[model samples]
Target: MTGTCGSCGRDDEDVVLVRRLYVTPEAWDTPGKVEQGDEERWCFVCRTHYPHEELGQA
Candidate 1:
């Protein structure tokens, strides 16, 4: 994946974290539809000078 780095003005694969959501289903072996309400975004260290801005307290 490619993204423009927020800082240093460079284009690279800076984001390292795997962006996804974890959901617990009522049944162990069944697949259920999930409501899209939350999204997790990840960026590289150099990209986010102020990392707190991207990863805020939930």
Candidate 2:
């Protein structure tokens, strides 16, 4: 799918649906509970270089 990456905001043809990038928080409301952020469309390059959980093809 060709679209803008949610991370880098770059146009790419290899964009796919992926979980939002995770950020380390100073404190967690519930420790040990993994919080998966919203899904977003991201280019393959950004997905490979950044921390993201793949959802599927966009």
Candidate 3:
């Protein structure tokens, strides 16, 4: 699927599926690249921003 990456804002066909959990304000009080509880397709570059464990990759 073609869509813009919520992280890098890249509009390309090369993308990977990413999953994130819903966190409350207290959990994400710090300023960082935290996803707001949703699954989205992100490009390879943007995908690298997230942790490998969270991606369910070995």
Candidate 4:
């Protein structure tokens, strides 16, 4: 699979994989809510600048 960096927008072979979670307004109001999301690949530059557990080196 190929994708661009979430930050630098680079689609190089080496990049970071990250997922985004989005919750509906109603879900947010509930005590227990499930989030829907998507995954994205980020460039090495972004991974270096912003490192997080959710972002995996691809």
Candidate 5:
């Protein structure tokens, strides 16, 4: 799918859906499980530049 990358905010055709892993404020102290944040579409360049868990194609 074609869309703006969530990371770099660049328009690209090869955008893909990725699951952003992050620790929530509530879980910061515990740090037991990493929470899955927003699923965003990212371009190939951003996807490579930033490490993220791939959910699938957008």
Candidate 6:
């Protein structure tokens, strides 16, 4: 099964899946290496939707 965005249907907008890339300790310590990855999509609408977080701020 693939991850899907709740609002839209885009693999890139998948709020569930995070395409992570793991590297060894040494590799991680290298000059330039990626430790994490980008997001997978569930919907296309995710591209247009804005993330709303509430921290007592507007």
lDDT string, candidate 6, 25-46, tens digits: 4455576444554444333344
Tens digits of per-residue lDDT, candidate 3, 1-58, equal: 5667756787865666667544334445665443455666667776665542234321
Score residue 19 of candidate 6 by CA lDDT: 40
Model 5 C-alpha lDDT per residue in residues 2-26, reported as the tens digit of each score: 8888878887557899987764444
Better of 2 and 6 by TM-score: 2
Report model 3's TM-score to 2 decimal places.
0.46
What C-alpha lDDT do the candidate models reach, one value each?
Answer: 0.43, 0.77, 0.57, 0.57, 0.77, 0.40
* Residue 26 error, candidate 2, Å: 11
Q: Which 10-residue window of candidate 1 scores lowest in summed lDDT?
A: 49-58
lDDT of 4: 0.57
Across residues 2-56, which tens digit of lDDT does each residue of candidate 2 receive?
A: 8888888887557889997566655556444356788888887888787778888
Regions more than 4 Å wrong, model 4: 19-39, 55-58
Error of 3 at 31 (Å): 18
The number of clashing residue pairs in model 4 is: 1
What are the runs in model 2 whose C-alpha is more than 4 Å off?
Answer: 21-34
Clashes by residue pair, model 1 = none
Residue 19 shift from truth in candidate 1, angstroms: 16
Per-residue alpha-carbon lDDT of model 4 for 1-58, expressed as tens digits?
Answer: 4566666676654665776554344555566544645666766565556533464655
Which residue pairs collide in model 5, if any?
A: none
- Per-residue lDDT of 57 in model 1: 19
RMSD of 3: 6.4
TM-score for candidate 6, please give it: 0.23
Give the TM-score of each candidate.
Answer: 0.27, 0.66, 0.46, 0.40, 0.63, 0.23
